[model samples]
Target: MKIARIETFLVPPRWLFVRVETDAGVVGWGEATCEGRSETVRTAVDQLAELLIGQDPLRIEDHWQVMTKGSFYRGGPILGSAVAGLDQALWDIAGRHFGAPVHQLLGGPVRERIRVYGWVGGDEPDEVAEAIAAQVEAGLTAVKMNASGRMSANGSAAELDGVVRRVAAAREVLGPERDVAVDFHGRFTLATARRAASLLADLHPFFLEEPVVPENSHLIGRIAESTAIPIATGERLYSRQEFLPVLQAGIAVAQPDLSHAGGITEVRKIAALAETFDVQLAPHCPLGPIALAACLQVGFATPNHLIQEQSIGIHYNRGADVLDYVVDTRPLAFVDGSIERLTGPGLGIEVDEAAVRDADRRGHAWRGPIWRHDDGSFAEW
Candidate 1:
């Protein structure tokens, strides 16, 4: 069927959803957003629509290639994220047309369920013990939290100790059976990251995410050599090419966001590339249901899949949570902290188009929160 029109919805709590309509009346849904820059990605999708309208909806690969390679200046967050959402919508259409789930088209699922992790400890991280306990009570076996707030280039010993203390509390609450992932959030310097890694080793974290920023990925191998803890990064990375070097750096886990890494088309390749280096795949998904469903489809099919991140109660979401816009939140039903197989066609979860349309009319202009240090200097949030 030929694509007839492309529509975008800027929904609540920082999400942009895209809808692709075809000549045969079959429509597909996609989540194409970059958190704060939902409007920018929406514009990018609008520009990319010129390449998709009147094209065959089933030709996902061709559309992806043209949408990506068609532009000489391609592959950053805006372009990749825009292509990502469109690709997801096209894949959804293809799967629905064939009466199969996306996983079946991708060689069927390799597992019945994939373990998922929840977010605990907001940006600054206080009362982590209580947060961990609450998530455990909610049936989550693992929880990820930010490692620290803003720190100087030369962080003090007290700052380092505070980081350890919070982690210690989380470990104490989680005990030994469950996992706790500490995200540095790219807020630490090389020396500070190394020091924190060394200090937190005793707490036995599941992984240290983005110890430094993506630019300092070269230091990951050195950091890995310093500590036994697995180093995980790549939520900021958008393609397999960007991920190849990090995998080569001996990173233990590759956390590519299915929404940001060119959707399923490119992330599947990223997963394969990670597997070659014996690196684990833990997709970074802190978005809505469409993005989460896309990640689960890949997670269920990938052999090296480790854990998936869901944004059910994540701090970024305000009025609208992950399940608010879904027609059947049951497909996302988690049991013992793991989501079972999605048996529906396309991305498996049917979105509430009416809710989406209503929310779109109320359109969001959401942006990430800005943080400042004690001296009023800007800090990553």
Candidate 2:
């Protein structure tokens, strides 16, 4: 079928959705959310649509190569995310046309159920305990939380102690059977990250996420070698080229966001690339259902796939939730801390186009929080 039209909607709670329809009346949905840069990614999608309109939708690879490298100035977050949504839509259309799930088209399932983790706020000790308890009460076996809020350049004694105390409280609530992943959020320097990683070794965290920001990925290897804790990063790294260096840096887990790292097309390659290094794949997906659904499809087909991240009841959802826009939430239903493989065609879960359209009419201008240090200096949030 020929691609007839492409449309992007800036839905509430900081998400960008793309709708692609073929001349044969097959409609596919994809999410290209760049969080703070929704409008920019939407514009990129609009421009990229110029390349897809009137082209054969089944020629997914050709379109991907063109959309990504066709422009000399390409492959940044905006371009990658834009191509991601369109690529996901094309794959969705392909699966629908073939009357099979996207995972089946990718080579069929390697596992039955996909393990998933929920987010817990960790600003305060009491709040951290309550959040972890809530997720555990909801049948979740694993949860991820920020290691700290506004961290100092030089690790403070209180900051280090608070992290230990809070995570210790989380470990207490979770017991030894459950898992907790600590995210440094790129707020800590290499030295601080190393120190923190060393300190938390006894806590037995599932992984320490983004200990150092993407800019300082050069330092990732240092921290990875310094401590036994598994270092996971790559939400900010947009492509396989960007991920290669970090993968070589000895990271035990590779966390590529399907929406940010070129969708299923490129992330599949990233998964294979990570596999060669014996690294596990835990997709970084804290976005809408479309993005999460896309991650699940990739996870099912992937052999090294680890746990999946979902944005249900996450702090980012102020007005809308991950399940709010999907027609049948059963496909995304979590049973015993894991989501069963999706059986429906395309991305598996059907989106509520009406709710999406309504939300688009009253779109949101969501941006991430900016933090300042005690001395008025900029801080990572």
Candidate 3:
């Protein structure tokens, strides 16, 4: 079927949704939300629409190649995220046309259920023990929390002890069996990361995410070598080329966000590349249902998949939650911290176009928080 029209909607709680319609009346939906830059990605999608309108909707890979590399200036967050949404929509159409789920089209299932984690503590984490307990009560086995709000370049011993104390609280609530992952959120320098890693070894964290900013990934190998804890990054890296160096740095897990890393088309390749290095794939998804569903489809087909991150009750969802815009919540239903493989066609979760359009009429201007140190130097948030 020929692609007849492409539409994009900027919805509440910081998300951008794309709808692709074909001459045969098949409609497919995908999310291209880049947390703080949803509007820019929407504009990118508008520009990329010139390439897809009147083209064959089923030619997903061909369109992806052209949409990505057709522009000389290629592969940043805006362009990659735009191509990502279009690719997801095209995959959705293909899966429906073939009467199969996206995972089946990608070589079928590798696991029965994909384990997922929930976010507990907020940005400046406090009352973490209670937060962990509440998530455990909700049938979640693992939870992630920010390590600290704003950290000094060379934090005092008290700051280091405070970090340990927060993790210790989570460990106490989770006990020895469950998992607790600390997300440094690129707020630490290499030295601080090494020190924190050394201190947190006794806590047995599942992984340390984004110890430093993506620009400083060259130093991750040293941090990885300093501690036995698994180092996870790549939420900020958009393509396999950006991920190659970090994988070589001895990171045990690769966390690629499907929305920003060229969607399923490119992340599948990223997963394969990670496989060659014996690293596990735990997609970084803190967005809406479509993005989470896309991540699950890849997780189901990937042999080395570790876990999935969902934004069900994540602090980012202020006005609207992940399930609010979906018609059927069953596709996203979580039981015992894992979701059974989705059996529906396309991304598997149907989008509520009515709710989406309504929310678009009252769109949100969501931006990430900015923090500063005690002396007014800029801090990562």
Candidate 4:
């Protein structure tokens, strides 16, 4: 069937959803949320609609190539994210048309259930022991927390101790049985990250996320070599080319966001590239239902998949939670710290069109926090 219409919704809680309708009464949904840049991605999607209308909905790969490479100035967050949502919608349509889940189309199930990690604490951690306990009580076996709020170019010993203390608290609650990961959020410089990594060595963290910013990703391999803890990054990276250097840097995990990194088509290729380097995949998904569902589909199919990150009760979902716009939450239900392989067609979750439309009418202009150090210089947040 041919694509009849493509619509985008800027829903609450910093998410952008795409709805693609085919002429033969089939519809597909995808998420194109770029966190703080929803409107820009929406514009990019509108531009892509010029090429998408009347095309075969099942030609996912072809559409992806054109949407991504059709323009000379391509492959940034805007275009990549726009192409990402459309690609997800096209994949959803293909799955529905073929009567199988997206993972099956990729190659069939490699795992029975995907282990997922929950987020504990906020941008700046507090009462982390209690937060870890609460997540464990809620049936999560692994949880991740921010390492520090906004760090200085060169952090003080007290700040370093606080970072270690928070991780220590989480480890104490999780004990030796469960897993705890820390996210630096690209707030640390290379020197600072190296020092922090040295300090965190004793805790045996599952991974250290974005220890340095994407711009300074070349230094990641050094950090990885200095510490035994697995290094994970790529939430800001949008293509396979951007991920190549990091993978070669001996990064233990590649955390490409299915929503930001060219959706399923590109991320599948990214997974393959990481496989050559023996790097594991843990998709970065802290958005809404559509993004999380897309992540699960990839996780089920990918062989080297490590774990999935979901936004069930994440700090960002203040106004609307992950399950708010979904008709069925059963597929997303986390049991025993893992999500069972989805048997349903497409992305394996239904989008509540009514709720989406209602929320779009009262659209949100959400933005991520901007921080400044005491000296008035910009700080990463």
Candidate 5:
């Protein structure tokens, strides 16, 4: 079947969804969410659609190469994210056409179920406690939180203590059996990340995410070597070539966003690359259902997969939640701290077309917060 129409929708609370329809009466859905930059990625998707309008829908890899490398200026967040959504839609169409799940197409099931974690707010000690408890109540065995709100370039003693204290509170609630991940969010300098890593090493967090920003990736190997905490990053990274340096940096885990890192096709290859480094894969997904579903599909097939991140009840979902646009929520149901294998075809979840259309009519222009330090210099958020 040939690709007939490609449509993009700007939904509520910082998400962009793309739909690909084939002439043979089959439709596929994918999430091209760039969080703060959905509008730009929407335009990128439209531009990329020009190459895919009449091509065969099942030629996923060929189309991905062209969409990604067709232009000289390629492989940034805009183009990678645009290609990612279309790639997901193409995979979904292939799965549906072949009457199999995407993971089965990759290879047969390697595991029976996938473990998942939720994002918890970590600004305050009480917030961390309550958030972890709520996730525990929701049957999530693991949860991730920010290391600090907007940190100074050189973290003060108070800043360092507060980070440790908030994590300590989460550790108290989660106990020993559960896991908690600390995200630096690229707010810390190399010295600051190194110091935080030394202080928090005893708590044994699931991982320290983006201890230093992507631009300073040359320093990550030093951070990884100094502390035993698993270093995870790559939400901002978009391709396997970009991930190579980080992988060689002796990181313990690689957290590539399926939406931002070239979707399934590229992330699957990334998983393989990380596998060679003996690192685990925990995809960075804090968007909507389609993105989470795509992550789960990869998790089920990937052997070195560590855990999954989902955005159900995450603080960002103000007006709409993860399950709002899905026809069946059973596939995404969290049980016993893990999601069972999705047996349905394609991405294993049905998109609610009507809900999506309605939400698009009242489109949102959501943006991530911009932070400035007390000195008025820009700070990472």
Candidate 6:
């Protein structure tokens, strides 16, 4: 079916959704957003629509190649995220047309369900023991939390102790049955990250996420050598090419966000590339329903898949939770902290288009918080 029209909406709690309509009357939805840069990605999606309108929606690979390689300047957060959303929509349409789920098209599922983790403790962690307990009570077997709040490049011993304390509390609450992931959030420097890693080793965290920023991937090897914890990063990375060097650095896990890393089309390639390095895949998804659903489709089919990250009750989502935007949250089938396979066609979750339209009318301009150190210097948040 020929693509007829493309529409975009900026919904609540910092999400951008795209809709692609075809001549055959089948429509597909995609989540194409870069958190704070929803409007920018929206514009990019509109610009790419110039090439997508009247084209065959079923030609996903061709559309992806053209949407990405079609532009000489491509593969950053904005453009990649825009292409990602559009790519998901196209796949959704293709699956619906064939009356199959996206995973069925991707060589069928390798597993019945994928384990998912929830977030505990806010940006600046406090009362983590309580948070961990609550999530455990809610049936989550694993939970992740921010390691520190805008730590300094040269962190003090107290700061290092704070990291140990938080992880210790989480471990105490989880009692070793469940997993706990600690996210440095790219807020630490090489020295600080190494120190934090060394100090937190006793807790045996599931992984340490983004110990340093993506630019410092060269340091990942050193960090991996120093700590036994699985070094996970790549949420900020947007393409397979960007992920290659990190995988080469001996990163234990690749946490590419399907919404940011060129969607299923490119992330599948990234997963394959990581597989060669023996690196596991834990897709970074902290967005809405569409993004989570897209990640699930890829996770179910990917062999290197380790775990999935979801934003259920995440701190950033105030009023707009993950299930609010979808019609059948049951299809999500989150059980015992794992989501069962998606059996429906396309991404396998029915989005509430009316809710999307209504939320769009009351569209939000959400942005991440900016943090400052005690000495008034800028710190990553």
Runs in model 4 deviating more than 4 A are 122-125
Can you write out model 5's per-residue Cα lDDT over 251-332, one digit (the tens) per residue? 9899999999999999999999999999999999999999998998999999999999999999999889999999999999
Q: Is 2 or 6 the stronger prediction by lDDT? A: 2
What are the clashing pairs of model 6? none
State each model's CA lDDT, in order. Answer: 0.90, 0.93, 0.91, 0.92, 0.93, 0.91
Candidate 6 residue spans exceeding 4 A from truth: none
Q: How well does model 1 score by local distance difference test?
A: 0.90
| 288: Cα error in model 1, Å | 0.4
Residue lDDT tens for model 1, 1-381: 799999999998889999999999999999898988889999999999999999999989888889889967878898889998999999899889999999999999999999999999634557788888989998999999988777777789888888998898899899999999999998898889999999988889999999988988877788887889999999999998999888888899999987788999999999999999999999999999999999998888899999999989877788899999999889998898999998899999999999999989888888767888888888876
The lDDT of model 5 is 0.93
Total clashes for model 2: 0
Q: What tens-digit string does per-residue lDDT give for candidate 4 at 1-381?
A: 899999999999899999999999889999999989999999999999999999999989999988888988877888889989999999999999999999999999999899999988735457788888988998889999999987988999988988999999899899999999999999999999999999998998999999999999889999989888999999999888999999999899999999989999999999999999999999999999999999999999999999999989888887899999999999999899999999999999999999999999989999888899999999998
- For model 6, residues 1-381, the per-residue Cα lDDT tens digits are 799999999998899999999999999989997999999999999999999999999889988999999977767899999999999999899889999999889999999999988898635447798888888988889999989876877989988888888888889889878999999999999999999998888899999999999888878888988899999999999888899988888899999998899999999999999999999999999999999999999998999999999988887897688899888889876697899999999999999999999989988888888889888988888
Predicted structure 3: lDDT: 0.91
Query: What tens digits encode model 3's per-residue C-alpha lDDT throughout 1-381?
Result: 799999998997999999999999999998899889999999999999999999999888899899988988888888888988888999999998898999999999999999999988635447788888988988889999888767899977988888898898899999999999999999899999999999999999999999999999999999999999999999999999999999999999999999999999999999999999999999999999889999999999999999999989877899999999899998788898899999999889889999999999999899988888888988888
Query: For this target, which candidate reaches the highest lDDT against the unseen true structure?
Result: 2
| TM-score of each model, paired residue for residue | 0.98, 0.99, 0.99, 0.99, 0.99, 0.98
Clash count, predicted structure 3: 0
Residue pairs with colliding backbones in model 3 are: none
Which residue runs does candidate 1 get wrong by more than 4 Å?
A: none
